[model samples]
Target: MALALPRFAVFQSTVRQKNYLRYIHEDGEQHGFPQFSGEEIVSPYSKFEIERAKSTTAEGNDNGFVHIRCCYNNKYWVANSISSDSFIIAGADEPNEDQSQWSCTLFEPIPVDGEVGSSTTTTTKTTVHVRFRHVKLGHYLRSLVTRDNYHACVSTSYDRRYSR
Candidate 1:
């Protein structure tokens, strides 16, 4: 049996005005969503207000997952698309279960993608190797901001020659 997810009895919103989720329009005209995609979208603490995420799908109805909308507007919060992170409020002309719909799930952010496969058979824990120093070990990985022809090992000792 599948494990059940958390649910909120009431979806509430505290806002003075309508919450508009702004996203930088990348390659297309500034307008309605889904057909056009934006570079990035963010629901900042100041601009947008989302105190709680509601699991509409868990209600056993056709809610199909969505952010609890602003109490005043009664619009559904939607992620623009999976491919693009741009976000917009669901319009009444469109269906509630459209691509704008989103579901909440428990997640642990990992360093890199593709390190973990999607299959349920096997699981893997991986970390991405970037130009950063390890705390315990004095060694450095990846070359970053260095003029040396070869990679130099950085020890615990501070050196003006090689900036840490």
Candidate 2:
């Protein structure tokens, strides 16, 4: 069976926030973990490529197994460790590496008052959120509540406050 692949997209926070996931630019180049930038502007640093993992079977395709690659730096997102609260960084330069793959699940767009879907006919663009679980770390990528820090890998089995 052939699976339909989703187009590349830029991820944004859905908790009534304006933050978008973007790679950090430092020392004259885009190098480092991606962070939530609330600049209200979508740029190349914010774009990401999603591709199907090579190890998946026809059955596994339905599970949404994939790899996320940063468009700015050309690196795959990876979780370094299984320990809770590990920083999910864009470190892997190779695609389909064990640590580079993720299980992606797209969620329905959240409805807000005075926004799209509030009326009978929706015309404005809607925002969709996604949940990506690291294949090797076995943790879900979550946005940090603090505005100063980057997103982290949190164990779904534990409470949010105790993520670290």
The best candidate in terms of TM-score: 2
**Candidate 2 backbone collisions, by pair:** none
TM-score of each: 0.21, 0.63
The parts of candidate 2 lying over 4 Å away from their true place are: 1-5, 27-31, 57-61, 97-127, 147-164
Against the correct fold, how does model 1 do in TM-score? 0.21
Clashes of 1: 0
- Residue-wise C-alpha lDDT for candidate 1, range 1-164, written one tens digit per residue: 22122231111111212322232223333232221111223322112222222323333222133232323233333433332222233223322433223321111112222233233646542322112122222122221223442112111233344333
| lDDT, each prediction | 0.26, 0.54
